[model samples]
Structures are given as C-alpha cells and as structure tokens.
Target: MKYNTILFDLDGTLTDSRPGITKSAVYALESFGFTDLNPDELNFFIGPPLLDTFMQHYGFKEEKAHKAIAKFRERYNVTGVFENSAYEGIHEELRKLKEAGMTLAIATSKPHDIMLRVIERYELAPFFTAVEGSKVDDTGYRKSQILKEVFEDLHTTDLSKVLMVGDRFHDIEAANDCGIDSMGVLYGYGSREELESYHATYITENVSGLAKEILTCE
Candidate 1:
C-alpha cells in the first residue's frame, strides 16, 4: 500500500459519538410521541446521515425525516455535541500520521458546521488537511458525494494514494463507489461481519492497529 492521503469518517472512526447521537435520536422520537423508543436502539444513527437513518429505521418520509433531523439538531447542537469524546488513542494516532506527512482529511455524513465545532473541541483540526460533510438538512449528500467533495477539495491526483477509513458500510461502500480503497474499524459502531461483508480492503480492530496499518505502508 502506498497511501499518502487518508480520509476518515467522523463519528465512529475518530470519536465515540453514540451517547450524544442516541440521546438526540431519543429526543427526536420522543418529540414525535414515540416515547417508548430506547436511546440504545438508536445506535444505528451514528454512522450514516440522520435523514437516511431515520427514514430507513422509522419509515419517515423525506419531509418527516427532515423534521426529525431538525428535532435531532435541537438537542444535538446545544448539548448532545458536547457529550462526545474522541476514542482513546485517537489523538495520538492522528498526531503520528501527521508527523508521518500523511495528508489526512475528514469526509463524513455529519453536518459540516457541527463537525467544525467538534474538531475545535477535540483539538483535531491541525491534523486534517480538509473537511467535507453533509448540510444541516442532510438532503442530497451521501457519503459518496461528500467523499468526492473532499477528494476534489484536496485535489487528489492519484487514486492509489488515497484511503478511506471508517466503521460503517456507508463509508466503505462510498469508497468503493468512488474507486478508492477502504479500511474498516471494528472498535467503533460497526462489526467485523459488516466490514468483511463489504469486502473492505483492510480491517483493523482498534485505533493503534489502524495507525500501524497506515504507517507501515503495507
């Protein structure tokens, strides 16, 4: 492997965002009077765009999904966002990759402005070269779309020099769709079975392993 540019997924790949995302999902569902819904059950919302997740799991129409996202953001923006923490060892690995002269970037389904806030809070901005994400509405952008945006923003010239690292199928699939290689992480929201099923180019169990995979140039 000869990757020089690494595109990372935000939530599961870099940070443990389940608590805040699940809480906001619970808040949004409860606002719709789905009071019995458990926050833990909403863990699936951590990776993909909220609109797609809400629509898939809850069968919300596009309009209703938009409304649900608005409700999700109501809590997410104020409190839920702050409830997150970067995974253990994530910062150290990012620093190692930066020191190795890797061009790191973020291509996530998370909304762009909120992503900026998170990067600042976690002190991750210095490591990434660029960032691309969905709009607050999460309307038209999928992982593939935003990944392409980041790809273009970074002016990537050789597809072989890029890698997409994430924990979900959406991330791997988008990388596949974009003709880039992918590495799936198991210590995040996704399972080994899911990553393998997608045939990710590589799969690692944790942050340190992930960094080793990249830095080894193998």
Candidate 2:
C-alpha cells in the first residue's frame, strides 16, 4: 500500500467548491430561462465535467450543453472561481505528505488555467509537483484523460506507487483504468455508496482520517 506519488482531485478532495460551482450552474440555467434551478439541487455538479452535468442532470443536448458551459464559465471565471475554500486540515495534511517526500500533483476536470488560479489563490501551489487539468475549450474533461496527462507530466511508470485521492466514483474508476490505487473522501460531495460501488481502495470520512491513511500506508 506504499505510494510515492499522489494525484489529487481539485474540486472536492482538496477544496470545497460547492458554492461557486452551484451558483455558476444556477446562472447558466437562468440563461436558458430556467430561473427556478435550485443551487442546493446542483450538488451533482461538484465532481464531474460541466458538459456531462449539464446534459445528464438537466437533459441538455450536446450543443446546448456547450452553450450552458460557456455561460457557466462567464460567471465562474469572474466570480465563481474565487468562491471556494480549502477543507480544514488540508494544508496540514499536504505539508505532512510533502515532508515525507511524496510527490503530489493535481488531476482535475476543471480547466487548467482556472485550476491554477484556485490553487495559487489558496497558496497550494508549493505542495504539488505538477498540475494537469481539462482545457477551457472543454476537451480532456474525463477523469481518466486528466490523470493520463498528469502521469505523463510526472513521467512515472510505477502505477503501484501512485495513489489518486478524490470524492467521486469517476476518480476511482479513472484510477482503476490507470492501473493505480485510489482513496475516496466522504467530506466532499460524493456518497459512500458511490465510492464503494466504484471499488475505491480506501475511504476516509475527513481530512484527518485521510491524512492518517496516507501516512500509515505501507
């Protein structure tokens, strides 16, 4: 269970971006004349790609999904992106991992530029060795694709020594596809049932638990 490298998912695993994402989603829905879209009901937007969320949750066609994404970015890029906060103890956990000599990286569905802004704003840029994310153009939104890019940037072939930590089924599934282990956190948007169904290697209820699991791993 030893790992030398850890890939993190940005939105839920490290930071609580629910407010920003939900607000932006509501803005997008409003643009389509759906003024009643509840921000609380938009929790599904936290982990997955915007395009998929728009289509899957709202029944938007591909073309309309793209448009909705644009509208989301219009607000998100200005206000929503900054409307986020790091989870409690996340900084301490990351510092501990870094001090232990583990390489850390970010693999997120968020666009690369925006992810960078978020990380930098939160002062998390120092801990991660690399950050790979989807493009603003909406390409490379799949967790698997994002992780592939992260692995490529890392230039590491030993998947056994790599661990991906996230809060969604997509993260675990992507780790499985990449031949790596994964840890799911419950303090984020995803449910325990979802993580378990995806066969995550481990699940933790909070940042402290997650830190303990990572530090104690073989």
CA RMSD of each candidate after superposition:
1.3, 1.3
**Model 2 Cα lDDT, one tens digit per residue, 1-218:** 39999999999999999999999999989999997678999899887888888888779889999999899989999999989999888999999898888999999888888999999999899999999988765432678988999889989888899999999988999999988999999999999999999999988898885766987776
lDDT of 1 at 85: 93
For model 2, the local distance difference test gives 0.89
Error of 1 at 34 (Å): 1.0
Q: State model 1's lDDT.
A: 0.88
Which stretches in model 1 have alpha-carbon errors above 4 Å?
A: none
Clashes of 1: 0
Clash count per candidate = 0, 1
Q: Quick one: how many clashes does candidate 2 have? A: 1
Of candidate 2, the 10-residue stretch with the lowest lDDT total is 133-142
**Any residue pairs clashing in model 1, and if so which?**
none
